[model samples]
Target: MTRPVGYYVHHQGAGHWQRAVAVARALETLGRPCTLMGTLAGLDTAAAPGPVLDLPDDRLDAGFDGRDGAAERPECLHYAPLGHPGIRARMGRIAAWAAQHDPALMIVDVSAEVALLARLLSVPSLVVRLSGTRTDRPHLEAFRAASRLLAPFPEALDGGAVPDWVRAKTLYGGFLGTAPATAATDEDGRIVVVFGRGGEGGALGPLVQAAAAVPGRDWHVLGPVSGTGAIPANLHLHGWVAEVRPHLASAALVVGGAGDGLVTAVAALGRRFLCLPEPRAYAEQEAKADALERLGAAIVHRGWPDAPAWPGLVARGLALDPGIVRSLAEPDALARTAAAIEAMCREAG
Candidate 1:
């Protein structure tokens, strides 16, 4: 009998769950049923071909009574507030599920403590890699404990940021969740502005102003864009849409936060993008946006541009070749990732 694969998705953003679903689907195609445990909504249990466990939400803002009200975690761990029953219960649930299923491999995308817990429970695991400063003890410990590390970006763009030890165990999977680009009829210079679920939205005002200045062009905002400011006649707010890939494919220009999902999707579709990376916890988005700028896949902005700066930013973004963005998608990216996970399962069996 083929042993099932287990996936632990972090609930920080929609991106983690999105990536998890793709991975689970891939595993199912490989004939290895997967079990996903997470607090995220909208995940299709049916997509996994196995049980989908909706664990209790353990986020800091979940308003659990036991929160320490402080940002700092124990020195050894990344994040586990003191006396938080939710954290304990959350980990306990994962532990119980793993014990009962005895999965061949568990994939975490990702949490340092949970990755560490998987190893402690004598379960083989793989942890997904995030960009930015992750060389600290907690991150290093998690990397050391995992059976393998999965990097979602292209190998060509991987500078020496990841340590040699970690890199030796890492598999660069190019960009995941890259859907085939749909042939777009002329959008007539339509621009899509997306601010991910997380991140500051102060830039929305300037972007609205920019849309007003550019005549005959339509601007669409997707995801959580919070502001009480005036709306431009040419601007359309879609809020949170079920699908964003098609929008990216058809857009004349795309602007948004430099979240991993956003950047990778744009790269895959080969769209002209202006990336304004909001402040991320580990500076992950910042690092990604910088690499994209250097690679000519995107034009990175430090912040929302002033009135005068908007026109120039838009022009520069449009001037970039979308081909550079398309080059980041490797043909074997998704296959390689699925194969690695399958390899781990096979080895365990």
Candidate 2:
């Protein structure tokens, strides 16, 4: 039986881990053994039976405040990449861990360096990436050296910079999570606002002010409303919930910072969205927003938070087309990704 070891890169969110878990489940259904690797926020191992190889806490993307990514984006890049010294320090230990499992294939969710190591050992590997962002240059170089690169979302949706070979392996897919999504739309008057993990702390204040300005509608927010004072009379605040999709599905529309999770989870549900992208942040998020806006999948807003369209934008969002997400989330998406990986391995020979 073929054995695959899945590696996920974690920083501020559990996206990589979530996607990897989905892909691993698909592999299992095909009668292939998969072991999960990496460390991420709230990644509880109790949910699955695979042996876990925890990665070190590498805070690579926690760059600066979410509001000032424009001023800090350059500096964020200059900082050590996530796969730097920490990974090297632990490789020997990682190698020993690999020895115990003797995995034949390594399925990585996002790390490019794991490609380098997999290469050194002549082990086959596959990469899983978010929908909107293009493949990283370092990762593309790594992908060329690997057995296959499987994209979970449509190549037409994003991944613009990816080379043809890797693109050939792209298999756009639906979410892996099996839990039924619970959208809150029946509460017709409510407006839902989602802020990503990094969007906490200082950014919440400005967003709270913005939400306050638009109180003509009932407001609900998820993830971070701390220090913004008692939840505003118009807003309902809840801590992070495992099922965020239903909230988007049930809402009139969505407002949030540009992040992988929102792009896949919410956009897949066909909600109209507005991206409050971090100012000086990763090009990927900004670029993803750019693509989405061009495709009319969502709206992109940055700069003085009080732009004239703020209210009208909210109005238009409330009028977004419904039931579009079902097409984006075609059933059997994860199954297709797993099948593609096995096909890539056969081709590599």
Candidate 3:
């Protein structure tokens, strides 16, 4: 009997779950069963291709404040708080599922502790590699523990920063997401400002100022915006839309953070991107922005540019070659990722 594959998705951001769903669908096409495991709160579990294992939330809350101080936690672990029932229950549930299913492989996208747990359980695991400087003890140990590393980006995005061994172990699956079926005509002088839920989005004041600076252009904001002053006539706020692709498709220039989902969508749509990478753990977005700028795929600004700088930045972004951005997307990325997972499952069996 062919054993099912288990995928542990991180609930922090939408990108992880989106990638998992895409990969799971591809796996279904390959006649391989997959089970998604994660905290189901706020996620669309119905989109999952196979069985869903909703794990207990392990994050620190007022009732379950078990987080350790920075200096007190183990060097090999990123977050292992003590006396958290949720964490304990979450791990126990995972272990129980693993024992019951005896899955051929465990795909972690991604958690160091869970990867280590898979190793302890004698299960072959594939860890989804994200873009960033992940040489810390915890990340390195998890990488070592993983049977293989799956990079959901083109290898060129690595920028040759990682060690030779890590590159060798990783299979670059390319960017995984659906591109727009048909290119929507770009709305001339329309600048779309996008934000992902993973990080604190762009400040409303800066955005308004930026929009006011370019009075001729129509500015549209997607996702949450904090801080409110006076709303500009040219600036429009559409908080957290269900479909960003349509808005992105119509953009003369896409301005957003360097998260995978936004980047993937922008790249696939061949949109001229102005990247304003938000602060994130391990400088993930910063590193991604660096890679994108280096690759000539985006016009990256370190922070929200001053009001006077917006006009020049907007011109630069609009002038970027769309083909260069499109090159970052692999049309067959989802299929390729699924194939890689299938191969890993076969090897494990």
The best candidate by TM-score is: 3
Output the better candidate (2/3) by TM-score. 3
Local accuracy of candidate 3 as per-residue lDDT tens digits, 255-330: 9899888898998888999999988777888888998998899999988799999999998998898889898888
Model 3 reaches what TM-score against the true structure?
Answer: 0.94
Angstrom error of the Cα, residue 92, model 1: value is 1.2
User: How far out, in Å, is residue 28 in model 1?
Assistant: 0.4
Q: Which regions of candidate 3 fall more than 4 Å away from where they truly are?
A: 62-67, 70-73, 181-184, 227-230
Model 3 root-mean-square deviation: 2.0
What does candidate 2's lDDT look like per residue over 26-119, in tens digits?
7777766677766544666665546666766444345533232233333212233433565565565556666665666777666555665666
TM-score of 2: 0.80
The weakest ten consecutive residues by lDDT in model 2 span: 68-77
**lDDT for each of the candidates?**
0.80, 0.61, 0.87
TM-score of each: 0.91, 0.80, 0.94
Decreasing lDDT order of the candidates = 3, 1, 2
Off by over 4 Å in 2: 58-85, 129-137, 174-179, 183-187, 201-204, 279-282, 307-309, 323-326, 342-349
Q: For candidate 1, give the lDDT.
A: 0.80
How many backbone overlaps does candidate 2 show? 9
